[model samples]
Target: MTPPDSQLPLGRRGLLAALGAAGLSASARPAPAAQRRLPLTAQTTEGPYYLDLALDRRDITEGLEGVPLDVRFTVCDTAGRPLPKLRVDLWHCDMQGRYSGFGEQGDDRAQSFEGKTFLRGSQRTDRAGIVSFGTVYPGWYAGRTTHIHFKVINGARAVLTSQFFLPDALSEFLYTQMPLYQRARMRDTLNSVDGIALKAGGTVLGAVREERQRYVATLALVVDPAAVPVIDRPPRPGGLPPGGPFPGSTPLSGARPPRPRALEGSARIRAMVPPRAEG
Candidate 1:
């Protein structure tokens, strides 16, 4: 089943503002990012560097095609329920952690969200395994701390990879005299957190269930029906890698999608399908 790459680009436009989670109105082009290039550095935490651009047909420059990401949460399964199509893998950095790829310096296209990568992607979980993304609201990234990393593969590999924070009671009333967050709060500090909870050890849970612009939570994984870990691994970031997902389908990304738009609005961008069901 190793067959899905075509180079993966066609038309060129809809990146929902380089996927920092995309939230705009009052005017579509507002995402012009006001000429961007604002606060740009790195090392910040709160992890999960988001940038793939929701379900991504690569988007239509902003008309926002499928238009998902109104937002929702939870994907329990330790004793809970729903684990249906499990495959979440978000990425973050942008509220300032200045991430886009490699070390990130001038002209990756010219930064801002540069050609925008590192915000990573992937999302599945329906039939009840729910999932959400239409992101935006991440904005303070100078040198770390804000968090949102997640994992729940269930099919080929990775069964969990936690980290979801914000709300140390506002960093203990504005980081009391420092000392590593002094007395800590946000659901009892990481006890000893560093470099983003050490790449998320012990399933982090600092706090903050819901904040404005957007941020929600709920995650739990424990899969080990007996001993499930074969992982031939291969079909990711490209297409159909490990070969496990096949309920309704749609995950094998080696490449292909990016061809149809011959005259949707003329400007170009096509490859839209689905129109049969005859009788």
Candidate 2:
């Protein structure tokens, strides 16, 4: 059996290197992004489960519980200025690897996880270009590793649509130790093996760690709202009704995700990791 990429464990130093190699971590102190040239967040497929639910809240758990995680995103522009009033939306599966509100699952849309709306919600960023969510650690499934999907929008315009990943070690611990998540068997995929992660150059992996009593994950997204290409595929901006596309929308295609520019230098960003478990 092949080893998982997360199994190789990254300390603060190593994490910084990865982020640097990906052109994500530019500085520890605040400086003009133009001077530092912050990289833009990479875009990924919205997948088949994306919905236009009219939800606006911080807690998307809908009552399921596992390891508590407070996910936050700092939305900024190339100038390092906060992008106030933009909306950030996130959705993920429960511990059982089952997503909500989908009657058909997977690419073929042959399975059902319908009648559920658990881990799906949107929160508008505050004046400081930050949006936070109260959710739990995601579990693994057959095809994909543990991850969370998110989108950033300024009114009707989509700024970025991407996913974030959890480290393999922590994901393994959750399934092997947590009763609720253990029900779904972990798969063989790793961050090193996930096509989207590879194509996005590791920027999709969130900087994560346990903070006090809960796990905290953060991602710094520098986006040029003016430059982000519009997504015209149906289920268009104002979002579609629950279980939408209303029949004439473009069909979800199996195309590859767009690849952004490669990292040009070797600068490093500090790493963040969860605290060690209590003995």
Candidate 3:
């Protein structure tokens, strides 16, 4: 069982202490300087469609349609310093909210997209603590809103796993622009309605803007390169066995795996404390 936030070291409690002693207001102190890196992105459910395709490239969109989006993910430490030369893997649904390599997905299990690999790839961070991906804005599905998944790794140690969400207005705008996405029935879930977004204190939302014909979204994923990921175990091929479930799903009795190593000290800090949301 997960411990309460208070019991967790370098968690919200430590953040509160710093905020109390410092005379700065939350709104006044921004997270990053040029592109301020936040401390550890929030850990979300890996879902049922995370497959390491072994394709490492920046451009993952294999001839999809929608507003082209350039995603910039910056990795940094808790001190707001950038960490260079790290591996970051990113994946998301296509313009129609259908993931590649998955036969079917969604709440009602209505999709039949199989062996399709698009808008999913891996890249390593540069000297500036960033991994830029050239892809299109993702569409929505039945139960979840518009979002993307990412994982940061150091050697074999999985340090962090998280998701980034886009504003509803942007998602709504894209659906109207592309006729193909219009067929994907819009769900009731929005970023604000997502439980993980709320718990992470809105840090999970990507700061996006339009640049000429394409949209550029940027967000910092802070993590400790040395810390073990706060997941049940390393990501397995095709997610779990046939009956095995995702993180938030009901597990089959005696099928659940042991939790990953207990996070210690400020490693817990990077895993626990959500970065202050920035515009």
Q: Summarize candidate 3's per-residue lDDT along 18-106 as a digit string, tens digits.
A: 43312111121237546744545677766566776757899888767656788888787766677787888888887666777775454
**lDDT, residue 56, model 3:** 89
Candidate achieving the largest TM-score? 2
RMSD per model, one decimal: 21.6, 10.7, 13.6
Candidate 2, 70-115: lDDT as tens digits: 8989888877888988888899877666678765443333657677
* By lDDT: ranked, best first: 2, 3, 1
- What TM-score fits each model? 0.24, 0.70, 0.69
Name the runs in model 2 displaced over 4 angstroms: 1-34, 104-111, 228-279
Where's the lowest-lDDT run of ten residues in candidate 3? Answer: 21-30
User: lDDT for every model?
Assistant: 0.35, 0.63, 0.62
lDDT of 1 at 143: 25
User: lDDT: which is higher, 2 or 3?
Assistant: 2
Off by over 4 Å in 3: 1-38, 106-111, 232-279
Clashes of each: 42, 3, 2
